[model samples]
Target: MVDLLKPYLDLRDAEVETDFGIDDPVVYGSRAAIESIFTNLIVNSLRAFAQDYSSGRLESAEVCFRKIIIRTKKLGDRVIITFSDSGPGIREISIDDIWIVGRSTTPKGSGLGLCIVRDTVEDMGGAIRAEAHGELGGAEFTIELPLRN
Candidate 1:
């Protein structure tokens, strides 16, 4: 997925860092849905960073202005995955509101991606949450799912 989206990332000088703690943690879910989740999160961060860059919020002096990190770890019975970025954080509204259908912060976004993300996670018997200011100083999404498929 990262390779497929490399052009956009390169265009905006964005970098992606992946941290997979387990060698090959297994989770059984719809392949397409899983890919969609990752894609949506990355794209949303990219869009947010684009806005920041366009508005001159990201200056030459700023460090780590557009980094997206995907980290995964395995617990006794669950797998935890976090996707974060160094762009602007979310709004004052609760993180839950960001998953509402047709709700969007971007100017040209239709707002369907996040809504689908929430639904897909719930359908897979997983739990997902968002933090406005995470380890990356921007928005973060953490998903927890059963280790055994």
Candidate 2:
């Protein structure tokens, strides 16, 4: 997942930190499906940073400190993966609407990223949620998937 998002992260000048808490954590899903889910989430974070930068929400000095943290943990028979960023967060009123197709908070967005993410997660028998307040002060996406037997 990190490799797939390297270019975008480099382009956005964003810092990424990853922590895999468990050894060889495995989930019940295809590689492509998992990749797609993470790709969309990372892309969305990058987009949020870009938008914030363009709107002057992030100053020049703070640009270098832009952070995105990806953490994975094993919770019993489930795996929890979290993607958190330091970019602008989703509005409280819009959090529930984020997964709706054609509903975008940014002008340049197609509004389908989260929609697809939710669909793919459900297809894999997993669940996903968005949190308005993240440790990084931006949007946080938590995905829970059943561990592969």
Candidate 3:
């Protein structure tokens, strides 16, 4: 999935970091849904960075790798996947309302991606949380999915 979005990543001078471990949880769900979860977040990060660049925010900011990091770890019967970026964090929208349809911080966003992400996670017996500024100093999304196969 990361490889598939290389164009977008390269356009924004960013990349993804992660190592799929042998213990990574595997849940039973639609393949497309799983793919959507990742693609949406990556695209969101790209859009956010693009906005910052156009507004001269990134150019003035300190230099960094500008990456998206995805890490997974098994905790009891669930796997916690943290997906984060190194761009300007979520802006404007409250963390509480970020997953709400039509609530968007990006100027051109349709405001539906995160909503679908929330619904899809819930439908798959998973839970998700978002942090505007997280460990990586940008938008962070932590999704916990059941370890059951």
- Give me the candidate number with maximum lDDT: 2
Model 2 agreement with the true structure over 24-78: per-residue lDDT tens digits: 7777778888888888888888888888888887688877767889999999899
Candidate 3 local lDDT, 35-138, one digit each (tens) = 89999988888777777677777654553457889888878888888899887898887999898888887887888999989999998899999999987788
Q: Estimate each model's TM-score.
A: 0.89, 0.94, 0.90
Alpha carbon deviation, residue 26, candidate 1 (Å): 1.9
Q: How do all the candidates rank in terms of lDDT, highest first?
A: 2, 1, 3
Per-candidate alpha-carbon RMSD to the true structure: 1.9, 1.3, 1.8
Q: Pick the candidate with the highest TM-score.
A: 2
Worst 10 residues of 3 by lDDT: 56-65
Candidate 1, residue 103: the lDDT equals: 71
Error of 3 at 89 (Å): 0.8
lDDT of each candidate versus the true structure: 0.83, 0.85, 0.83
Backbone clashes, each candidate? 0, 0, 0
lDDT of 1 at 137: 87
